[model samples]
Target: MLPGEFVAFIAALMAVNALGVDLMLPALADIGRQLGVTTANHRQWIITAYMLGFGAGQLVYGPLADRFGRRPILLVTLLGFVAASIFAASSQTFAALLGARVLQGLMSASTRVLAVAIVRDQFSGRQMARTLSVAQMIFFLVPIMAPTLGQLLLVTLGPWRYIFYALACFAAFVLAWSFIRLGETLPVERRRALSLHTLAHAYRLTLTNRFSLGYAVAASMTFGGIIAFVSSAQQIFVDEFGAGDRFTYLFAACAFSMGIASFANSRLVERLGTRLISQAAVLALIALSVAHIAVILSGVETLWSYMAFQALSMTCIGLCGSNFGAMAMEPVGQIAGTASSIQGFITSVGAVIVGSLIGQSYNGTTLPLAIGYLGIGLAVLTVVLVVEQGKLFHARQAA
Candidate 1:
């Protein structure tokens, strides 16, 4: 594929994961009602279940991709995702739906792993970060539009299950696209053996490397805040603020801010360096979260105030995410698939656990989310400090 097409394809692959989550946001309430679920918090399990599976499944895909090459592994996973989506659409019970969602997540895990690995196979250091930011800038459009699309489907189609069908169709299209156009980026000479010893060594290298592990943890903490917001967004908008059908648009605005920030980061990363840019973003996020918490505590918070704080916070997150992921993978280029998998596992599972706490702590207000963001920002700063040995805003020349 050409450079532009390659970036767009990467974005499309990553967007499948976003579509799975965001497309379900507007339908959470409807799904709850149809499935006989009464408690608002209980509905969060729909998203959480998928994340849990997605996280754990990464462990397997990384090693497989390293051994089998990216093309075949990705194609297989896309097929699995389509089947899982169909299974989800056919669910009659809440438990069954959650099961199908977990399966969907497991299949979807390959997208995250392979996208990062494929990028790593071709680029490194700041260039890799720049590429990821550009891809994310494009990928973020899915979140920007998915909830509104979900709402439209619900309004016109009159069922939540159609969302799953829609997802399945999209996955099938992607699968066909990959079959026709996606080429193997990993060379045979670079392929790792699929064995217990090799897997253990690759994972150990990923886990023991200070920059790799620390940045992974830091990214996970920062991402937890994003996940928390996503988990509680429907309730905060529809029930708390009475945004009703307008919630989708409000959510889209926050996503749009992230996309804009991602585009800016893509332009700035090569010059500023990932370490300098991401460290600054972490500090900014902390400060913003502090202000956001104070506003919520003062009882002066409104829909617009929440939106402003969230959009700014997400922009900082957008800056941090691509840079952090690039840094984490930098020292593990030889084992990119394994390293990406480990990081993906950490971020997805850790974020889900953290996010679920904040989501469940909802007391008909935004305090939990505000406080959650502050805690995440602080935690991320702490991790970065230890990892960088108290060095902040230090820029390294691009490789």
Candidate 2:
């Protein structure tokens, strides 16, 4: 395969990672309405349930992938995802739908962690960073059109469940693709022993290693912050700010801007290094969070301001995000799957706490959203500062 073709394949697989998350965005309201979800607040749980499942299940995938290999594990999980998507499509009750969605999220997470592990198996340092950057840059197009696609599917097909049916189709394709094209990245000779003793040690070492945790935390928070926004964005924009379909497009614009940052990082990561660029980007996110807070305090609550500050924060996140994952997994090449699973677990734990808070706190305006952003930004930056050992590294180092 040409380099370009491989990149496309990776990007397509990566896009599947977002399917369970992004495709359901526009349906938040419909699901809530259809299920008679009385509380406007509880509606976000439809999304969060999936996240919680995805995040929690990540731990299992890494261990399995490390022990078994990426191809077989992903093959199993992707099939499970297809079945879960089918269950999600057939559900009428809120509990049933949420349960299926949670399973879908958990299963999809295996795919995601494996994709990262697959990268770690074949590349490291700058090469890994560059590959992940290209993959992420291309894959982000999923979120851009996801909500709009949801809306269109909802409007044209006349049932919100059809959205899951569409997701099932995508999952089926991924299942077939993996079986045909994915060889075992972690060969048996290289596989980690699937023992509780070794697994415990890996978790302990991952949590204790400053460099690994630093990069992992940086990656986690970057993603955690975005999850906060995603959980709240549709309501904040469509209900509070009134952008409707444009909200999806606006969110995509911010994502595309971040894609530009990731692309640029891909080109320079080998030259400058991951540690330097990630530190700088996190600092930028902190500043943007502060700016977002100011917008809320300025006595004006408007859609334009929300979009502006949100875009800024996300751009910084995009810049630093991929490198953090690459760096965290670089040293764990032999156990990349297990390591990637640990990485996902920690990140998801953070997201569940931080993201759940942000999603549940919306009070019919952008103020709560802005405040949440500011708070999370401060917390993440504090983690960075401490992890980086009392100073910020602002150099344009390569990954």
Candidate 3:
């Protein structure tokens, strides 16, 4: 495949997760009402449950992919994802829906773990970062339009379940494309045999690498903040600010800002290196979070103000996220699948807990989200300092 096509394909696989979450935003109210859910905060369980499962599920896929190779495991996972989506669409109760969502998340874990492993198999260091940045730039498009598309489907199809059915169809399409276009990247010579001992060894190698482990923790904290914002976005915009129908537009704008930042990172990472760019980006996030929290404390909440701050904060996330992943994976290439799995599990599970806390703390204000962002920013900065041995902004020589 061409480089552009390769990036787009990888991005499409990754975007499946974003689609499952973001597309549900416009339909969350509808889903809740239909299922007799009256509690505002409890509605977030729909997203959090999936994230928790997604994180836990990565533990299985990493070892499986390492042993079985990427292509076969991915195909099997996609099939499960489609089945789970169908089950979710047919749910008659909130419990059933959540169960199916968890299953879907479990199956979707392969997309993230394997996609990163595939990229790592082909590229490393700054080039891997650049490829991921470009893929992320494309991946942002799904979030940019998913809300509007969900709203459109709900309006035209006359039910919220169709949103899930649509997701299944999209997964089916991607699965077909994978069958036709994607080949196994992990060769037989490099593949590990399936055994508990082998799995334990790979996990040990991944976890003991101070550089990778520290970044994994840092990335999880940063991801937690973003997930917190995502969980509360609909409430913040529609219920608090009264954006209503315009909520999709505002969400799209924030997503667009991230895409722009990813494009900028792709252009700059090779010359400036991942360490410098990511350090600068994390610091920028800290400053933006502080400013946002001050605005919240001043009692002057408005849609424009919220959007301005959030867009900049998300841009900072885009600038650092892929770079951090690249750096973490650089030293653990021999166990890329397990390393990516561990990384995904940490970030997803951490995000679920932190995000649920912040999301549930919504008291008709944006203070929780602001505080979550700032707290995570500071936490990630500290983690990065330790990872780099108390240094900041210096690029390491690539191995």
TM-scores for all predictions: 0.99, 0.95, 0.98
Off by over 4 Å in 3: none
Candidates, ranked, TM-score: 1, 3, 2
lDDT of 2 by residue, 280-365 (tens): 77767767777777767787757777777877777778877887887777666666777788888878777777778877878887
**Candidate 2 clash pair list:** 62-337, 62-338, 269-398, 269-399, 272-397, 272-398, 273-397, 273-398, 274-398, 274-399
Write candidate 3's Cα lDDT for 148-257 as tens digits.
99999988998999999999999999999999999889999999888989988888888899888888888787777777877888899999999999999999999899
Model 3 sits at a Cα RMSD from the real structure of 1.0
Q: Write down the lDDT that model 2 would get.
A: 0.79
Off by over 4 Å in 1: 397-399
Kindly indicate the candidate among 1 and 2 with the higher lDDT: 1
Find the candidate with the highest lDDT and give its number: 1
Lowest lDDT block of 10, candidate 1: 390-399
Q: How high is the lDDT of residue 217 in model 1?
A: 89
lDDT of 1 by residue, 1-399 (tens): 999999999999999999988898999998999999989899999998999999999989999999999999999999999999999999999999999999999999999999999999999988899999999999999999999999999989988999999999999988998999999999999999999999899989999998899988888887778788888899999999999889999999998999998999999988878887788887888898889889988989999999999999999998899888998999999999988999999988988888888889999998888888888888888898898888787765552
